[model samples]
Target: MNLRLYSYWRSSSAWRVRIALGLKELEYRYAAVNLLEGEQWSEAQRARNPTHQVPVLEVERAGQPPLRLVQSMAIIEWLDEVHPSPPLLPATADGRARVRALAEHVNSGIQPLQNAIVLKRLREKVPGWDRAWAQQAIAEGLGALERAVADGGAGRFCHGDSPGLADCYLVPQLYNARRFGLETSGFPTLLRIEAACAALTAFQAAHPDRQPDAPSSDPATSPATSPAAAPAAAGRSP
Candidate 1:
């Protein structure tokens, strides 16, 4: 299993990739791409991903092109597809659909609206967009997600008693939400799921603050962060 993950320590997408790798118990090499320093823009990374993103999965075989894959969601699903050790998708089609829906709520909906790029754009244009609206948008999205999850499962994790791809995506989105000082106190389900994730070693090992490149606690680190963001959770099961 000659696998390599092109990662940024603080990237939520990269974080997702790390969680997927850890949950699957796949030992892969790590290649750091410093997003804060524009290292992702290098011709080398661009040749690999073409999207200029972190968390590129370089799947090497005995002799192959070393298949470089991008987009965190695709990478995670790919891991599940190839490994299939602990299935990331549920057994039934309906179960798989439900989990994917919840995951997409964060992946497709919330993430794009309040992404780093969007935040940077808003920061330059509007005065209060930096902390104010970003938090609001994130909260609103999470609120909707909470409602959606209510229609699914919220047992120990987002989709079931164990974590899946949905949980991986959810935790990172929640982490980013908290980064903007969003009021998640109203979202009890989200909080509970986050708690469940924190108690597990896999999730604990994948935390951003635990990573080397993550910054120290600072008021200017953004308004949405708190001391209570750390937690552990489960993953694909055999």
Candidate 2:
């Protein structure tokens, strides 16, 4: 199978897919999509995903038409189904539901509120609302996640000792929380899980700083770098 991922370096959703692909030990061509410069609105990108989002996956198999998949959660689930050696979800039905619930706590409840497009719209209508809104959303969502993990029989990772779907959703959201300047010391459980994930090469390779389109310098200080202009060698492997 030939796989290609359309991703933005700092996008939490794309980061989730990156982590999933890495954990599955799959190699794919990295096609960088720069969200900072409105590249996601381009004709080509829109054609790939009408919603105009990053983390679109293109899959090619023998004697079949190529498949274009969108939405990070859907793509990751499909990948997990196709490649089950290192399962992303638990084996038991109840366990899968628990993990999916944890994953949705981040994917549905939190991410949309702080999404770039959502922030941009808020900024246009209500001046100076983006940062505080994103911070609150992340903080509240993470607070709930912390309590859920604390009560949900969490072990080394979110579900059990294994790093599964919930962990894949989590680490990136924590990154976003930090980027938005939220103090995360309150969520010790989530932080502990994040520490465990940090030790894994899969999570390390999926980090925003390690992406091909990431700026050479600090993204906060450096001017926006176009993915089209950058070389695609950085994310060639896990």
Candidate 3:
């Protein structure tokens, strides 16, 4: 597809892009942007995305400069629109709205509050900020999400039978929620949906642990196993 993705293995937003690419079966070159090393703020990366974020999809066309697209949800939506075979959003506007709402519950409500940058700032400013602060925020958002799903009559996935954009957003946030030590067993519905997603090849391929840049003890540069394994200040999904 002549696509190049600036990505980080652990960033939820980047993870979302990864899942979308996998689901659409679109091949793209991956450029790892080491967010924990402050690489997102570097001149080259910032030139690609002024927001200095990972998960920027560079769409390359013949005889033209690569088109840089920023933000995970926006990028996913674009992918859905451009590659419409297996649709990410449902056929109905109402279904699309419901999915978007669920996705936002994680992308905006939970992720923004709990990501490395926001949590770090809170800890720096607050008297005794702890991971619990993020935990509480995530718990609240998940609780609301659970209720929304139950009330909306969610099927195997967030929308109907098929996995959609909401599922993409949910899985990564759930991963981060566990990393931050939040107890997610309370949300049985989400847990069920997560398990279903786990069985999918696309979701499995997009997992942080499966990424080429995933942290490893053998590789010092591995973000997962390194001393600086935590995500950077601007590390959350956008």
Clashing pairs in 1: 178-224, 179-224, 180-224, 181-224, 197-232, 197-233, 198-231, 198-232, 199-232
Q: Any runs in candidate 1 off by more than 4 Å, and if so which?
A: 215-238
List candidate 3 stretches off by more than 4 Å. Answer: 217-238
At residue 224, candidate 2 shows an lDDT of 32
Best by TM-score: 2
What is the C-alpha lDDT profile of model 1 across 105-192, one tens digit per residue? Answer: 8888888888777888888999666777777778888999988887657678888898888889888888888788776788888889
User: TM-score for all predictions?
Assistant: 0.87, 0.92, 0.89
CA lDDT scores, all candidates in order: 0.76, 0.86, 0.80
Q: Model 3 over residues 1-238: C-alpha lDDT tens digits?
A: 4677788888999999888887887766667888888888888888988988888887868899768899999999999999996899999988889999999889889998888788778888894675889889988999999899877558999888898899999999889889988889999999999999998878877778666577642232222212112232111111
lDDT by residue for model 2 (71-178), tens: 888999999999996999999999998899999999999999999999999999999989999999999999999999888579999999999999999999999999
Off by over 4 Å in 2: 217-238
Q: Would you list the clashing residue pairs of candidate 2? A: none
Q: Worst 10-residue stretch by lDDT in candidate 2?
A: 229-238
Q: Superpose all Cα atoms of candidate 2 onto the true structure and report the RMSD in Å to 1 decimal.
A: 3.8
Q: Can you rank all candidates by TM-score, best first?
A: 2, 3, 1
Error of 1 at 120 (Å): 1.7
